[model samples]
Target chain A: MKLRDFVLRRIILAIPVIFGVLTITWFLSYVVGDPLAMYVTERTPDAAIPGIIRARGLDAPLVVQYFLYLTALFQGDWGVSTTTGADQPVLTVLARLFPATIELSIVAMSIAIVLGIPLGIISATRKDKAADHVTRVFALIGVSMPIFWFGLMLKYVLFYQLSVWDLPHLPGGDRYNFRAFGSWQPTTGFLLIDSLLFEHNPALFLDAVVHLIMPAFCLGYITLAIITRMMRSSMLEVIKEDYITLAKSKGLSERVVIYKHALRNALIPTVTVIGLAFGGLITGAVLTETIFNWPGLGRWATNSILNSDIAAINGFTLLVAFIFVIANFIVDMIYGVLDPRIRFG
Target chain B: MSDELVLHVKDLYVNFYTYEGIVKALDGVEMFLRRGDTMGVVGETGCGKSVTAKSILRLIEAPGRLDDGQILFFDQDFETKETIELDLAKLELEEMLEIRGNRISIVFQDPATYPNPVFRIGDQIAEVIELHQNLAMDVLYMKIAKLELTLSEATSDENRAEIEGKISYYRQQLDDPPEPDKKSMREAAKLKAIEMLRLVRMPAPEQVVNQYPHELSGGMRQRALIAMSLACNPSILICDEATTALDVTVQAQVLLLLNQLKAEIGTSIIVITHDMGVVAETCNWVNVMYAGTTVESCATEEIFAKPLHPYTAGLLIAVPKLHEVKDRLPQIRGTVPNLITPPTGCRFHPRCDYATSVCKEKKPLLEELEPGHWVACHHPLRS
Candidate 1:
């Protein structure tokens, strides 16, 4: 099949996946009771409850409500937040919070990929040497250590301990000093980008980056470890392949043989992990965000879940599922490119 | 075939350190390849045939170390016209790179897995040419075009002198062009790659050049591999079970192609295989390896007619003859010994029918028993 056709088929196939996710989310939310329950108090009138249910299409039959939900979703109306933002559109709330998560996730993912892949390659190439053993231990710690604990530890050592020792201590939590940038307006909602691009404040960008380091590292460490392990094993397998021997026999430099010939094939599996891990990073940022006090979707989702905000919960689940679907679609496309054996029909 | 020795491997030893034990993969493997001979190193599975081949290129990876040996390559320095004797085993990996693909190339078994699955067939072939030849493809193209144009426009005898001057100038440029642009280098390599594909008799060279390894048939992939190996016209070409992975028909075709290419390219070919028939068909000289050691080395006809070592005799008897009918095709007694702690003396002693107290107690050195026939057996069958 042509590349275009293959891509189109993949995109078309994603529709059902997203639809399935949305349906599941809707069903799960239905089981959780009325979303407007929190609004009802001892002073609340029984008459107001019916108006709220009717206005939100909650009084309709289950099937009818589902159809209405689907139609409204297609029309870009994700319903109003019931508890968290109170009367605000779910989409708007999600959109406002989405960029922060995206920006943090992007930074976290960059750290994972940049460090993970090379570390893995080094470990594999060195095999059982000191370098290999060191990375292996590092990866072990990264994988086994709880994210919350790691974040807390990082804050203790880098923030708390540094302050105690009278060293240049990093900010413990939160994203930038709001007191200094109170007058600053966010153009992109990504402080780092907005600070530099629209605000033209290099000092603001620096501060944003400074606050970003600990949280991003804390979030990315697990994925980096996973990627490093994946890359190492993949590279080890690829390097042992007959093609690698052939490449070496061709009198190509070691760099060419390893990087050009072997690395591409090895990166195939690593790319898969990276793509999936990216989606995980976005959704799994809850602990990191909560610990660091970063205002992102994960923190917002936490409050929404605690408040039993079904609409907001559904919106978050659907968005995450969509991200996963998109990530997998991209991974599949990359597989086709990396491995010629994969023919999309 | 030239009498000059192209490569001589002496007392080669390779050991693989595994969790179980150290696998003495290649122990004292000794062989020689003359300038233009298709020598076959035949042995059964796990006899270290591939290890010997890899040792020649110093391509042994970690865990498998070249324990001890001298791979003396009589490399001809083109500019000086002097033969440089370099020990392959002694040289560092970086130093070996110049000779690995340029002076010696190997085509491995499993052609499907050997050529990188991701790269185009043409690019893989072109990459080798670009590395060794160091010619700017774009500049080379321009020079060739100019020369062809000059030759085509040579209609008058009066201006022949001027045309000759232009032709020589273009030829000089073709011989030594300036450093090429990356894009032009690729283009040049692609053109050379097409030429190589044609040389290997790959059908529809133009289309095949653009296709990936998976797009080609088994025979075609092997052919493409051969083309890649022979791209730089290395002095020695090693085929490590090159045709063993193919079906009977394609095997014959590839073997035929190897023989034909050997003659055309003037490369000293080393065919590593376990099949005796392949030895009889393509090789002039056969080096029979038995359990990481050369049990016998002689002319192919001599070894077949007058087998020396008992192991060699057993191997010959094992081949199913067409005319002779038997209840069970003659089989060797014991399985190949584990190299980790191989039998005390000779590795094949336990498996040999002619085993005695001395055979078990002592390792036998390869001795020239007769004219041009070497055997490492304590007891030689006097048939």
Candidate 2:
């Protein structure tokens, strides 16, 4: 086949992948929660219910509603979050929360990458040795423990038990930092950003960093363990390949062969795992944000669910879908960047 | 110079530590490759030919370990040393990289499986360049462009240049490289890559270089890989049953290409194949392996004419040659022995027609019966 034609085919294939995400988001809003049930409960006046239903556009056909939602998505209108009285647009909510979530997620991913890949490589290379066994044990514990427990444990140890971190007070149920955040503004709506942009004092930056550390670490710790194990297994498999053997035959250093040849190939599968996890991270840290009172989407969604706020629920649901789709998309793009064999599809 | 062996695999032993027990993959096999010799090691699926090739640079992973062996490489051409006996058991991670792909490259049997599905063909090739070469930036770029241009028509020199330059720029931003050079080593590497691809007789060498493994046909990808292996001009080339996955016609084509490359470039080759036809067609030396051991070793014509080992003779008889097709083709009884606990005596004793009491009690030594021929058996079946 012609080379250009093959690439063109891949691009065409990606269109469906994007559309698939959109469809999944729309379908999830309907089945995931009873929007109708919540819609009526708020204003159950028999006469007002229909008007509310009609006004909310819930009365429209599924396909039409979906089309409208998709059209609005393109127009950058993610609809309104009815519950927060934040009444902010869906995309706006994402914009406000995305930076924070992304910052948290990126920090988490960075932690995972920096620590995980090396640990995995080391563990794999060492094999049955004590060091390998230790790493394996750590990875096993990391995997078996749930992220929610880790968040609570960290909060207890750092904030209560150790008294290492003295938060003057928790933010109560939402994510606004009412504490004396010294001269910080919402430049990026991210603590690191606001701290960097607005605060002149080094202490504020340090505080913001300190605040970020616990939640990010809690969120990313499991991912790091997962990545390390995945990377190790992948690396182990690739290192045994004849090509790697050929690399060694060339008299190249073991470090060069594994890093340059084996690790690079191993990353192909690892990218898939990392991408899915990144999507999960982007959807907002549910447990970690709740434990830290970080006010990200996870905490917001949970509160909205409890309040039975349909708008917030739908908006957050669609937003989570958006983040997931975008995450996969970005991962797809990165696969090509990292390995080169992956096309857009 | 004729006796200047480029690589010597001495008494190689490889074992995989599975949950069951130690899987003796490769056991007590020895061979060598001269500067320009293309040697073939042939055996059945579980016979340890591929493991032997991988043992050269200690590419085995856990729970596989190189139990015993030495890999000797004469890297004098690059001003390293004349004779370096590489211990297969231990090596620092960093030092092993130089030996892999940089000095001794390999091409696998499955061409489709060769590429990482996540990366582009150009990037994968460029990575090898990044590791091995110190070429100018412009040249490195030109080389990639030229390689891409050969594989895909749309991947123009401009686009290749742009992409490669972007990669270099990104690397520079990370402070990974020293200062930028006037003529990019990137372009030179690209040109060198193009020249190598063209030499492999790939049509549209410019287009094929840019095309991904999936984009090209099976034959083309194999050719591209062959071109990639030739990129650094390594002293030893290992083709691990490289043509086993291709059709007979494509296999012949690739084999012919390997022979041609061997003649033109003087790259010593270790062709790990199970196909006897391939050994006869491509290799100067043939090493017949059975149960991880070199049961018989001889020159191409000599071994075929006067196969001394009963196993080698059995193999020749089992195969239906072009000259005659028997109604009941001769078949060897008994399957490959379990490697977990390999047979105590001669591994092939149970399957051998000439097996005796001594064959079951004592293992035979690999002795040089003639000047160049080596046989390992209690009683050889030579006329």
Candidate 3:
């Protein structure tokens, strides 16, 4: 029942999950005919094809190739991208792009959490009032709107029309001011932090923040809506509990009864949603990144998939799967903190 | 000691507005308690016992309003050196907060629901202590700031060290307070909470204080709840079905504890329960309720000895006795009437076997038949 042992057990359980994800991605990407299909074309150099296939280890048996993939994966060799033809390792490419998605997801999740929980509490406390109705309408619109369309509309409004109306041209689509920081000076990988700390450019940091707002809002709106609705309903249910009555009977302030007593228990479900949503944000970054021209893993993965870049696709799936498992593990730990009933064995 | 009135409720009415109808939960219910006396509000389910208790505290939230009532709480006003009557129903929230946990406290039905599960028992008890306990120099920082400003404005260098020393003393008390002083106020509060636990006979109060509510058994939880409620040394403690959720053995133990507490702390108690046995054993006075109205009020022995109200007689007969021989236990006919459209006249007329034309046409008010006994009935039992 110890917390450390519980955590260790969860980590052990995640191994099989990671392996399953990697195996599925490997079989789907590698087993389908040629790994070098994207590199091949109807050219006159037919004799060089066998040499290229042998060079890429496509000549090995299926089982041997699986073991080789696992070994190379353990050794941090994620194979090479076939689309660029520059022999760039998938690991290095993904490493370069992953932080942009992480930064975006962090900002987006922060916005969701900051706005969602209090709004939900307000909606619950003022149930059936004007405040509740307004929040419900806002949540409905936020949930129903398509993210892609929402992103484009945001760009059109804030970046285009708003800029024309005498505002500074808001940064959009790009990660940072590429002109100022020309070389990809890898520091912390997170552009916001790297721009400030590594690049030593406050302008770049401010510019990155400006560019981040629109896409972050577009991505975060759905999570905010879902969290708000969840919190409202959960708070409503928890507030009706006898514990809440007992809390008020103790003459504790209404704030303490609602937040300290009801909200802590209500938030158990919200934590689960937040964790799952964070993982979804990572995968969902593909569409957001494409619209915003963010050079993150999602955009890279989409490009790789279109080009049949097998190695890049495999690495991306495994990485996302690992992050998902870790997020769920963290949520479980938070549940233990929130409710004393859920003791781990 | 018993003659000193602690709480007096007159014509208290509580109504719950629901989609179905407005439930007149407590319709003109009246009761009074004296110092160190335990008064039991005995009634069947849906008889407004809990409602009456909640109304006294003005804890009836939205959709359920304290429609009309006067809860006159008598307490000593320290500054005035006289007992003051507080109309709890009219008191604003700020004033209510001062009286709620300090002068009056409550022990709820289910012990499991009383303590917040996330916090340790020590923290829960300590919170109440910290809320009620006001230490001298507790109005910290602002006074210190004003003193610092005065020290700064002073042009003389001669008295600078003395002023500086005074500032440092206040600062030390603000930061790491010394023992037996304003600085160690929180520690003192925690110690008081633990002392309360010890008073409730919680074994190894030191270890139990650190554990969460889930770590304790049902009996322990109830004991902890009692401990938490008594931490402020409240003048009146309301036990709203305090022992109903526990097993029989634990129930007896808890009742014994409450009796011991009443003797030791001299706190008047309002025991709201449906259990007649609990009333017979623990209560000094019994008030029988039916459909949100008190049908009978008398001393426990007097009510049992010469039951005047037909409803009270029915309740006494319904209780299964060990010495009596019967194939099947006697039970009262029919269920509790719908309070929203409650029976006209006497609410119990429909279920009363001795219901007369007078009983059906007119409601009998609670009237004193003897010196210490009161009953609401048209057909009074003659001895």
Candidate 4:
């Protein structure tokens, strides 16, 4: 198949999976807690419960609710926020929140990819040498530490008390006093860019980026350690194959043989672990999100649960479900790219 | 023989360090492959046929000590200088790199296992061309384009600019290109690989180009690997058990293809196999290895007519020839000795019918018993 066709085909395969997920989310919404009581009648008098249920259409049959939900989706409605009376649409919440979640996940995964791939290649190449031992030791340390505790420790040491370069209060999540900027001010939701906007100088961007140094590092490191170890193990296996020996015999540079011929083939197995690390990022390392006070999907999901806001919870669940399905679909398409033995319409 | 002596290995020893002791894999093995000749090296399993092939390119890893050897290549001199000993200690990484794929290429057992699964066959073939054929853009295009027997109007300057624009967009992967818009560079590589596939007599060469390894049958995949191996028109091709996995019918076909390839390209071939029949049919010269050492080496007709080495004689009689049906195929007694701590003196002594105290006391070197026939045995003088 042409590469473009392969991608489009994968997207089409994801449709049913996406639909199935939303359907399950919808079913579980009803099964979990009394949505009728939660949304409309928990505060209402007992005599008025039926009238309230009837008014809001909950008294309708289950299949009817399902059909209505499907219909509402087609009409560009993702249902309403039943708790806040905010009139915000589920799509609107998702559109606003998805970027933040993606950005965080991207940051965490950037850490995994940047650190993991090289560490893996180096460790595999070195094998039983000292470099391999050092990487293994560091990877063990990174994997053993709890992300939340790590994040909190980073915040405490780097930001709060001694004020080591007093990093700007966590951007967006921790709102800083604009007046504190004194002679300089900037506009934009992204703090690094905003800090650079006023003076059109990179110093402020650097300062903001410098602040980004710790939190993003903390967020991405552990996953990097995980993916690196996985990549190293897989790379070692591929290097042993006769074809790899053939590749080396071809006079390919040792680096080229390992990366181009060996690692690309070996990457098939490591992809799954890296994928899990990505999902961990998206769903939120709850502790990391909480410790850093980063108002991302993880925090959003937690607050909704505490507030007992069914609409918010369901929206978050469905959003997470969407990310999970799409990530796996991407992983599958990548699998086909890597192995070529897999074929699916 | 003087001009064609491309590789000469003398007393090649490969020892691997293990917990119990050093594993002697290849023990003082002497081997030689001349240019333009297909030399079949046959031995039973664990007999170090693979170790010998790997030793040519110096592919053995650490813990595997290359105790000795010389592997000569086709260099500028084309005479004695061309013959480099297959010594792991003498060459550096840079020297080995120049020799490995450029001078010699290897086609392994499974074609499917050869090309990396992720890359398109086109990219894989094109990479070899890109590295080896250092030519300017248009000239390179014409050279490759000529091989396909047609040059597109797209090579014209006005058309070239247009194509470059399309290529830029392709690099971006903006959207799906139409059929005519497929990357010509990629298509060029595909054309080359397909041409190779056709050269090896794989049917529907065009059909298998875009297909992955698994899509091709085992025989076809082996053919594709041969196609890849010949990508550089390598002076020496190592077929490491090239037909071992194939059935008899397919094996014959692949052997025919190898013979044809050798004739057409005039490249020396090292056919590594355990199949004596294949050696008889496909090889002009043969090396019989026993427990990591070459016990006999001779011209095919000479060895078949007057086998000398006890192991070689035993190996010859062990299998029944299709024409000479017998009630019981003669068996060579005793399994191959453990390589980790191989038996001292002659490794094959326990299995040899002629193992006297003298035979067990010393390992014999290949001694000329007749014109062009060398045998390693205490009794070769009698033969």
Candidate 5:
């Protein structure tokens, strides 16, 4: 099959998958009871409750409600946020917060890949040596340590203790200090990009970066460890292959043998883990965002869950499913590039 | 064949440091390859035929060390063109790199797994050629640039035709070009690779070059591997059971190809296998190994006609003959000894039917019982 047709087919196939996710989310929300309960209080009037339900189309038959939800979804009308954004359209709220999550995930993924792959290569190439042992220990710690605890510890050491010692320290939480910058207009919705581009303030950009370091590191640590471990084992297996011996016999330098020949084959498995981990990072950053006080989708999703905002929850689930499907598509594309057998097939 | 040795391995010892114990893989393996000679190193599985081949190029991986030995390579220096002898065992890895793939190349057993599946067959072959060749990239670029300019300026069809011919000539030279500048060298190596594929008699050399190893048949892959091994025109080519994994017909064809290539390229060949039929057909000289040590070395016909060492005779008898019918084929009395604590003296003592007190107590040296025929045995079957 042609590359274009293959890609298009994959994209077209994702529609049913997303639709299935939306249906499941709706059913789960139905079992959870009325989202309007969170809006109700002892001070609320009884007559107003029926009006609110009717206005939101909740009074319709189950089938009618399902069809209405699906219609609104396709018409670019994700329902209004109930508790989190307070009457703001869920899509708009998500859009406003989407860039922050994307920016954080990108930074976190960069940290994971940049550090993880090389650490893995070193660990495998020097298997059983001191370097390998050290990397193994580091990976063990990264995997074992809880992200929240790790983030707290980082704050305690790099922020609290350092500040007490009158040494240089980073901010404890939040994307950036709004009071210091007086809330410059967000051009890209990504504070890091906007701070530099629109405000033309290097200090704001640097502050955004500084604020990002701890959260990104904490979020990326597990992924980095996983990637490193995957890479090491994959590399070890690849180097044992007859082709690697042939490569060495060809008088290619050890560097080329490992990096050019073995590494590419080894990376096949590692890339798979990386793609899934990236999807996980984007949707699963709730704790990290909460701990760091960063205004990303994770924190909003957490609030929506706590509030039982069914519409928002359904939207978030569908979005997560979409991200995962896209990520897998990308991984498949990469596999095609990496392995010729896959490309031809 | 020339009297001068292309490679001489003396008292070669290799040990594998495994968690279980030290595997004495190669024990005093001694053999030599004369210039343009096709020598067969025949041995049962695990007898260290492959180990001996790998040791020649110092391609032993970690956990397996070249414990003690001298792998003397006789060659002429690249620049000086003066005859030189270097101990491959003692050469620094950097120095060894100069010899590997350039002066000595190896084709492995499994054709399926030996060529990287991800790379094009042509690119893989080109990589080996590019590693050894030192063609000038700038000259190639200049030649191409000059051709392009001449073609653009030429008004007559005849002049264009003449320029195109010169361009192709210069382009072929690009195939022999050298260095780290990847693009030009890759193009040059690719052109050379096509020529090599053709030399190995691969069908549609141009198309096969672009195909991956998995896309080709077992025989074709083996041929491609042979092409890669011969890309640099190495002085010595080691085939480590190169035909063991093929179909019977493919095996014969590969053997035939190897013989033809040896004669055409003038590269000394080491055909490592346990198949006596392969030895009978292809090898001029045979080196028989048993339990990590060479048991006999002689002309192929000499070894077959007058089987000496008890182990060699046992091996020969094991091969079923078409003329002689029997309920069960003649078999060696026992299995090969474990090399870790191999039979104290002659490693083959436990397995040899003719083992006596002397054979059990003392290791026999490889001695010349006849001119050009060496056997390591306390009791020679026909001495």
Candidate 6:
């Protein structure tokens, strides 16, 4: 099959997957609680309650409501959030928050790949040695440690305790300080890039990076742990393949045999884990965002749920599902590239 | 160089430490190879034929240790007129790099899995050629510089004559026609790899060189592997069941290729396999192994004509004759003994029809029953 057909087929297949996610989320969001309860108060007039229900389309039948929701969704109408009381569109809210989450995820994933893969390679090649044991233990601790606690502990050490040493206090719980940075004019919505591009200040970029460091680390800890452990086991498995022995028998150095011959084949499965982990990272950011006060989508989604802002919750679910499906599609393309057998098939 | 012993493996002992027990993979295995000879080490599965071949280059990994062995490699170059004896086991990995593939190379079984899938054919073949050939030239260059230094200081005619002779010898080692430029060495190696591919009978050598291993057919891949092995003109070529994975026609083609190489390249060959037919077709001398030990060793024709060991007799009988009519072809009874806890005395006794009390009690050493034939059995067959 041609590469063009393969890509096209994958994209067409994603439509149903996205539709299924939206249907499930729509049902679950309504089942949790009635969205009308937020607007209804003890002193409210009984006549005003029906008017609010009709205005929000809450009085419509379940099927009618779902179709209305789908129609509005296709027109890019994410509906309004009742949590802030100002009634802001969920799309506008996402625009304000997603950049922060994206920025955090990028930092975290970069750290995961840069540190995790080589460390994993080292662990596998060293096998049962002290280096392997040390990496395994570190990954174990990283996995078991709760993100909230890890985030708070980092805040305590890097943000609070270092004040006495005259080190620049690390920022946590927010994207950037509005007072010091002068209200960040939206450019890319990514603060670090925007601070330099629109604000045109090097010091602001540095401040943005420092503010990002703690939350990104806490957010990325689990992903790093998972990738490291996955890569080590994968590398160990590929190293035992007959091709590796063949490489060594050819009198190639141990370096070439391990990295070139073993690592490339091993990376096929590792890439899948990485793609899934990226999708998970976007959703898993809730606790880290809460602790660090990072104004990201997770924090907004949590606020939406507490206020019974059904439309905002539904919209968030659709976005998350779309991200995951797209990530997986990209992973499949990479798999074909990595293994020729898959490419031809 | 043609008449000299190129490889001599003496009293080689390899043990694999497993949870069950110490698996005696190779028990005092001994074999020697003269230059230009094609020797076959034939055995049934699990009999340590492949292990012996790997032991020569110290390619055996952990869990398996070379407990006691001396792989004496006699390194002699006719062009350079240099001679050295290297006990391979005693050499460090760095030192072994100099000899591995450069002086001794291997072609493994299952060529499908042997060449790295990610690498281009040319790059893989060129790698060995560059490492061995480039390093050889570097060493030669160093020697030439030292010879020039010695010649400058020498006042006596005797000393000058000696220095000049040594200088010319080292210079000749670089190139036959004295293309002494070091820069062209890498290009020379690449050209040599292309030539080697053509020699292996690979069609469209230029196209195949750029293609990945996965693009090639099984026989073509095996032929490419053969080309890589012969790249450095290794004096000792170990083919560890090289033709086992090939089809019958490809097997014939490969075996024929090896025979042609033996006459053309003049490299001593160690062909390890379980196939009796391969031994009959390609080998001048044969070593029949039974459970980590050399049970019988003789000239290939003699072993077939008048088999001495009962085990050898059984193996010969197991091979079906083309014209012979029978309900069932003869088979050697009993399975291969578990190496973790092998049968104590004369491992073949359990299956041997001629087993005696003495055969069950004593383990026999290889005895030279005839002038050139050796057998490790208590009760020998009469010619």
Ranking by DockQ: 5, 1, 3, 4, 6, 2
Candidates 4 and 6 compared: the better one by lDDT is 6
Write candidate 2's Cα lDDT for B1-383 as tens digits: 28777777778888899999999887788776777788889888889987777677566667788888776676655575556655434666666666677778888788776655444455456557656876544453454556455445545678667666655554454433444463465545555666777888888877766666678888887887787787788878899988999998999999999988887877889999877888888888888999998898888998888999998888888878888857888878898899999887899999988999999899898889878889999999863
Off by over 4 Å in 2: A1-152, A164-188, A198-202, A222-252, A262-290, A295-303, A339-341, B1-17, B23-27, B30-38, B68-105, B116-183, B232-235, B323-325, B368-372
lDDT (Cα, tens digit) per residue for candidate 5, span B223-299: 99999999988989999999999999999999999999888988899999989999999999999998889899999
Q: CAPRI verdict on model 2?
A: acceptable
lDDT of 6 by residue, B49-152 (tens): 88888888888988899999799999886689687899998999888877778788899999888887766798788878877774456446656776798889
TM-score of each: 0.93, 0.74, 0.92, 0.83, 0.95, 0.87
Best by TM-score: 5
Docking class of 3: medium
How many clashes does each candidate structure show, in the order listed?
0, 79, 1, 9, 3, 2
- Of 2 and 4, which scores higher on TM-score? 4
Please state the CAPRI-style docking class of candidate 1. medium
Model 1 residue A231 CA deviation in Å:
1.1
- Which of candidates 3 and 6 is the stronger one according to DockQ? 3
Interface RMSDs of the predictions, in order, are 0.9, 4.3, 1.4, 1.8, 0.6, 1.7
Error of 4 at B272 (Å): 1.6
Residue-wise lDDT of candidate 6 within A1-345, one digit each (tens)? 598899888889899999999999899888998868766768999989889998888898999999998999889998887776687888888888888888898898888888889889999999999999999998898899998899899988888888757797787567777788677678889887877878888888888887888888888888899989999999999988888877777777899888888988998889999999999999999998899888789888888888888888888888888889988988898888787657735
Listed per model, the TM-scores of chain A against the true chain A are: 0.95, 0.82, 0.95, 0.82, 0.96, 0.95
In the range A227-323, model 1's lDDT, one tens digit per residue, is 9999999999999898988999999997898899999999998998998898999888999999899889998888888877777888999999988
Candidate 4 residue-wise lDDT, B37-125, digit = tens = 78989889889999888887788888787877665554433455443444444689887776666567787886657766666655665
Tens digits of lDDT, candidate 4, A1-345:
576787787788778877887788778767776776455434667888778688767889999978988888779777766443465776776665565456556766887788888898899999999999999998988899988777777677656654546654434223222354444442434555556665676765565455455556777888889888998998898898866876776678887888788987888888888776677777655566666565456666676666566667767777776677677777877877677666453
- Tell me the tens digit of each residue's lDDT in model 1 across B25-54: 988988988888999999889999998998
Our model 4 lands, by Cα RMSD against the true structure, at: 6.7
Pairs of residues clashing in candidate 5: B134-B178, B135-B177, B135-B178
Per-residue lDDT tens digits for candidate 3, residues B1-383, read 55878898888889999999999888788788887889998988989988888777777888999989799999876578599899998999878877776788889999877778888898788878877776434434444666788898888886777778887887878765433454356655666677889999999999988899999999999999898889878889999999999999999999999999999988889899989999999998999999999999999999889889888898999889989899988888999999899888888999998889998889788788988788878887773
**Model 5: DockQ vs. true structure:** 0.88
